[model samples]
Target: MRELTTAETVREKGSWLFTVRDQYGELDEVILVPCDNESGSASGQASTDGGVEAWINRCTHEAQRFDTGRGVPMREGRIICPKHGSMFDSCSGYCDNGEAADTTLPSVDISVRNDGRIVLTDDELTFVGEGGIDDNESDGDDGPASTSHIGF
Candidate 1:
């Protein structure tokens, strides 16, 4: 497991976007959003008041980058996609409206240490600096890696 950032940093911002290397050494972006219950209480007893939840930064509908521009909007326990106004339950990544109904955002497994260090728990080390793609899935072609982020 690799430490992504300290708990205090997440607490202050409420959410954060970062990139980590997958098991295959490919760069994958993730977003860490703090979860709060209906009572406005955090999930864990950590000093940060809530456990930081991680998810892939892509929107399930059009596969747009949720972390782009102003970033995903959080309301109550849901994340609102800025493009289509789709609302997704932050915890489950479930969307019930817009073009993304009945879908869910990809989730990234993560854990927060007792001392407040958020770390990736998927056996992949979270890269702390810079970003690069070393994906085996990518062909030698230097064309666009994806078309999901188009029309945005």
Candidate 2:
């Protein structure tokens, strides 16, 4: 497994650390965005100092899977949903798409292990952030980017 360049700390409602791990199996990745707050609450929590949050990459129109490429989580801030051009909150997966549904990206149950390693289960990996469409069975042309965002 390789950690993509998309891994970085960001400031949203709280201090969040985002990392996209390339599992390279049935699912191409496990995007982990964890909030570092005193309360560690996902809602109504703000990182007054400076932090970040992360959301899934599912499409807004049909809930199709969106690609984050090698530059995932947008270090500069904001991930444009590749499918519908909707800009989702990279930290929270909330979309301003303005519809009756008011849908947001999916999130995982994140926590720190005893050894200080962020342990995320398979079920948690599947539902990270906003976009919730599975592309595990996508075609060859639909695979994730093979580039690196770190050394760039």
Candidate 3:
């Protein structure tokens, strides 16, 4: 288990982002959002554990990013997909009323430590670093030769 950040830090924002390398060794981004409070029905009502939950950053409908390197837009314990406005419950990750209805966000395992820090506990993922995967890094090859010949 690798400590990602304190639960309090996630609760303070509408959403949190982190990076991890999956079993395939490809970097992926995950998101953390505030779950419902004690009764577990209302969102962002912080408790001792901070009501934190984790999920893959992509929305199921269009694979749109939930965090996109910034905080996600949320309401009442739900994560709203900015593309089509599908709302997913932060706790259950289920979208019941939109293009994503009947689909659930892919879950990422996580746990809080005694010290109040949240950690990535998924067996198939290794902690990479903070924030989303940096697309700037690339292979030595110049990718595809630019077709437009309006060269520099």
Q: Distance (Å) between predicted and true CA of 45, model 1? A: 14
Error of 2 at 152 (Å): 37
Q: Considering only N, C-alpha and C atoms within 3 Å, which residue pairs clash in candidate 3? A: none
Computed on alpha carbons, the lDDT of every model, listed in order, comes to 0.67, 0.42, 0.80
At residue 150, candidate 2 shows an lDDT of 64
Over the stretch 106-149, how does candidate 1's per-residue lDDT look in tens digits?
A: 77777777888877776555564422223213466788767686
Considering lDDT, where higher is better, how would the candidates rank from best to worst?
A: 3, 1, 2
lDDT of 2 by residue, 1-152 (tens): 22222223222211232333334423333344434444433445563222334344455567544444333433234545555566655545666664313666666444443333333443424423222224333355754566566653
Error of 2 at 102 (Å): 2.8
Off by over 4 Å in 3: 37-49, 135-152
- Candidate 1 — worst ten consecutive residues by lDDT sum? 128-137
Best by the lDDT measure: 3
Candidate 3 per-residue lDDT over residues 47-122, each given as its tens digit: 4455788899999988999887668989887899989999998887888999999998888888878777898889
**TM values, all candidates:** 0.69, 0.44, 0.81
Q: Give the TM-score of candidate 1.
A: 0.69
> How many residue pairs clash (N, CA or C atoms closer than 3 angstroms) in each of the candidate models, in the order given?
0, 21, 0
Q: Name model 1 segments beyond 4 Å from true.
A: 38-49, 124-152
